[model samples]
Target: MAARITARRPSPERRRTARMTSSDWANPYGVRKPYGSNGANHGDGGEKGATLSADHPLVPWKQPDHVHQWVDVDHSREELDRFVRNWPDLGELLDANVGHGRVVIVSGPPGMGKTTLIHRCLYEVQQRVAATGPSAGDPLAVFVPTAGLENDGRRISVDPDGSFAPTRLINARIRSEITKKLLLHEFSESRVRAITAEEDPYQAYGEMSDLLVQRNALLFAVIPHIRWNDAHLRAAFLRTCLSHAHTRIVLFVEVSHGAAETAREVAAALSGSAAVTHLALRELNSEDIWRFSRSARAANGAPNGLVEPDRSSLMAAHDEWKPSDVRELRKVFHSAADALRRAPHPWPIDADALRPHWERRRAGRDALLRHPILPRSGG
Candidate 1:
């Protein structure tokens, strides 16, 4: 029988010391509290707000897992169809790269849903793996957000408690756990070997290379904004990963107007690598945008009797909600979908335009409920 692991209880003195250390690392502004602890009082010198509760919106859910939803990129079904259909190309590219030990770089402007597309591909691959099992050797996708890594490496102001109060400690913990799980799941045996190997700790890339070699899994590294100076190192890593025939890698760099030059430089460096395939994320066409919105609405179930209004209805509603322009409307719809997924309670639709329709439906239901009272079977 497998041995059971039990939780260990810490002594009061240890708990107090831990709390003090946590408080020391907490944010001065107290915007972000310590994990499992509350913020320090801003007005009072004493730690007044130290209650443990699930008040933070970012806290992990304790009940049923929420479903995922999306916003329409724009009002375009045709474009969405194209995007979904084109997703297979990514898988094909991955398979081809894995065969030859190559790298595929996905680069695009911010808000183009590059990360979302990556997640979608990973989700599909996971489903396939679930259906076919390990014998099929389904490709594993790991996302490493560079921003999180940078934040982890950067020094933060700490309090006497040795805690990061203002910093997003929960977010950091969640991300760390995610990264840990990905690494463990992808390279279990290789990880053990890497840890046991007698190598200089400073030369960490070599260990990563070893892990990749052992697992034969594809790594999806997301770098939001690429820097010109980091190009060489990034290129080196890609070259190393692709040196082995079983390892496939992809670097998704998200760029914006301010970082256009950096994107250009990085693109140039990646271009020199024969193993890398670079693709830019373009804006979604109107049809694609529409489809995204529709899909998001459908995934969230759109509520009973809340028929997804046609594009015409949206346009009409857009005219009425003037100050809340089309852009605002889109944002609201996106938020609504997200709420439907993440919110604990069913999201209520209270928009002035939607309210009347819902009210009418309620009235019809009430009438049906009263039908039995108005007429008897004999009458």
Candidate 2:
């Protein structure tokens, strides 16, 4: 007697439901139904079963390891010479103690070339190091620009308008920006994470201080603007660097008329310490202006090679020209040079104005004069 064997099979309704469940799992929000089989319609709609393709590239891909080269500025020979001459003590100080732990502060009026000189120093120092192998523990120069401190503070989101939220904010923005950039560019993620996670901002600062000291790094701060409470900011900076006695920190503050008093006060505080040395920057002379124009023209290339005549020709033609005249010519060349650099079609300045041009082309002259780099006629 054979036992009757029966196997239970899923009902048709059950099979259909299973298939439907699988389909629902594949496209939960009915995106495929309305949008066809194409994987679209995932908009702001909260659909559950959607997934991005596996190979989608993300923003901020690992940047190549880049060594930031110092920026080059073209100052006239005269201006460079004058700066060196005026700040003879600074040159001496740098020469003597740069190997040791000496901090030099170059502060002065805006557009007076504080940034320029610092760049020059960095380039020179690096060049010296490269030419002659560094002595044991010779400090390596590091230039940090303080132009974007507010943005660095994360106070102003950098998404929309790029302006600072408030003008009165302390312009320690440069320090913040430089710190962020240095962290991003120079340090490892784990090291940065460890340093930044410290409770006090000054702790991270102290870490940088120690790191620089260990590496014998010379830090040059290019501060273009300062606020009323800049002393507090500077104190924090000094404390951070001074915590490690071997770290040398140079502060180059570019003083604007509005911020001159504050800059002076900050400089006074920094100067109170023997470790810090302060030097004021002065306006470039005509020769310096000429050299700057020439270098800028050569490096950037002038329009039609006519924006600025050869330096010798310019000097010869304008030998009798007043310093003011040379200044105006340099401005014209700078404007034309900039325009050439930025635009596909270059605007050429009148070659004659490298000497003297026709009065009829006054409009052209006015156009060139309108460049922001050019000083206003009366001023």
Candidate 3:
């Protein structure tokens, strides 16, 4: 009989110091909180986030459990087509923001890596801040996801015990950003609400800006949700930020719906303003068939992802796959891989070996995609 595992309760002493303390070497922040304890973890590289040279905890949902080490820069470039377009390079975005303080709106379809690209860019920019102070050499930059903020501009939260509790994640992020002197906010449209009398994006933007000004920090906000609502002039918010800051402002608006309308709004909003640059992302033009579609018999002879000689057929294929759909495509690929994990050391993941399973997945993948995306205009 197999032994049953049970949840062990922590003793009083253990519970008292349940939290992990951060070393001065690990992170500048004193106490590091793990994921799901109170809120999400901010950019602390765990075993998962360690895959990349820089730590990005905000978008952990997008991380792959096992990316084959064999995939080189060329392979990743070929595989990740979404990041290649609007962002030809993350350095460009960083340079524009750091050098000019420009607001860059990255518009694209859902799952096309808008969030992934933004996070990656911010991570690289932040490394400069981590190494030297924003005042030391380079301007400091910090990445913040605004899903947790309230529109009233309130930064503190009250617990049931009537004690004032601030979001550790936001507090940690703010501490890092203010200390560094750059604030890169990842503001989401869905989660934000109007706490103050002003509407969302405006009210929220005002509050955040006031906080940054109070702290005397430079702002570099990246908002994934820039909805197109022509009914009200949304340009006011962008214009407001631009007017206040002597520096250029960036708005990385990843629009899932109304890309055309959103772009038009941006252009109209910044008609006189030359600082705001809007970049649009489209699908990749490449061969649908992958050379590595030999996952079935190919898995048998390979030593941990290294395929053997000649008996090669990789897993994962798509007839009508789009570049932006890579995230969804990986979900299907991993699901198939998980289903086949126990069968053999290397699962036969070729088209023939996995087609039936994929068909079942397609047939049953009936859930409506919640995020609305505009069609890619052109290459």
Q: Give per-candidate clash totals.
A: 32, 6, 22
From the highest TM-score down, the ranking of the candidates is: 3, 2, 1
For each candidate, give its TM-score against the true structure: 0.43, 0.46, 0.48
Model 1 clash count equals 32
lDDT of 1 by residue, 202-273 (tens): 233334444654564555554433221234544553344344223344443433222343545545644665
What is the C-alpha lDDT profile of model 2 across 1-379, one tens digit per residue? 2222222333555434433322222211011211222222433222344432211111110101001111122232334444444432323333434443445555544334344455454444455544443453445556565553211222321212433223213323333555675564565556555655555544555565566655555555555433213345445544444332233445544433322344456465555565654555444344543453443321111112223324543433333432222223334444444333343332223233323322333345433211122212221
Tens digits of per-residue lDDT for model 3, 1-379: 2222122233445433432222211211011122443223323333321112111122322222112211111123432343334332223333424433455555454444455455444444454345544443344344444332111112322223433332332223323333233312433222222212233333444454544333444455554343323314245545544543333224443344333444454446666545555554444333322422322111111222312212222212333332234334444444454454343333334444345455555554534133322212220
- Best model number under TM-score: 3
Better of 1 and 3 by lDDT: 1
Instruction: Tell me the deviation in Å of residue 11 in model 1.
Output: 68
Question: Candidate 2's error at 270, in angstroms?
Answer: 3.4
Best by lDDT: 2
Off by over 4 Å in 3: 1-101, 129-140, 148-216, 226-250, 258-274, 284-316, 320-324, 364-368, 371-379
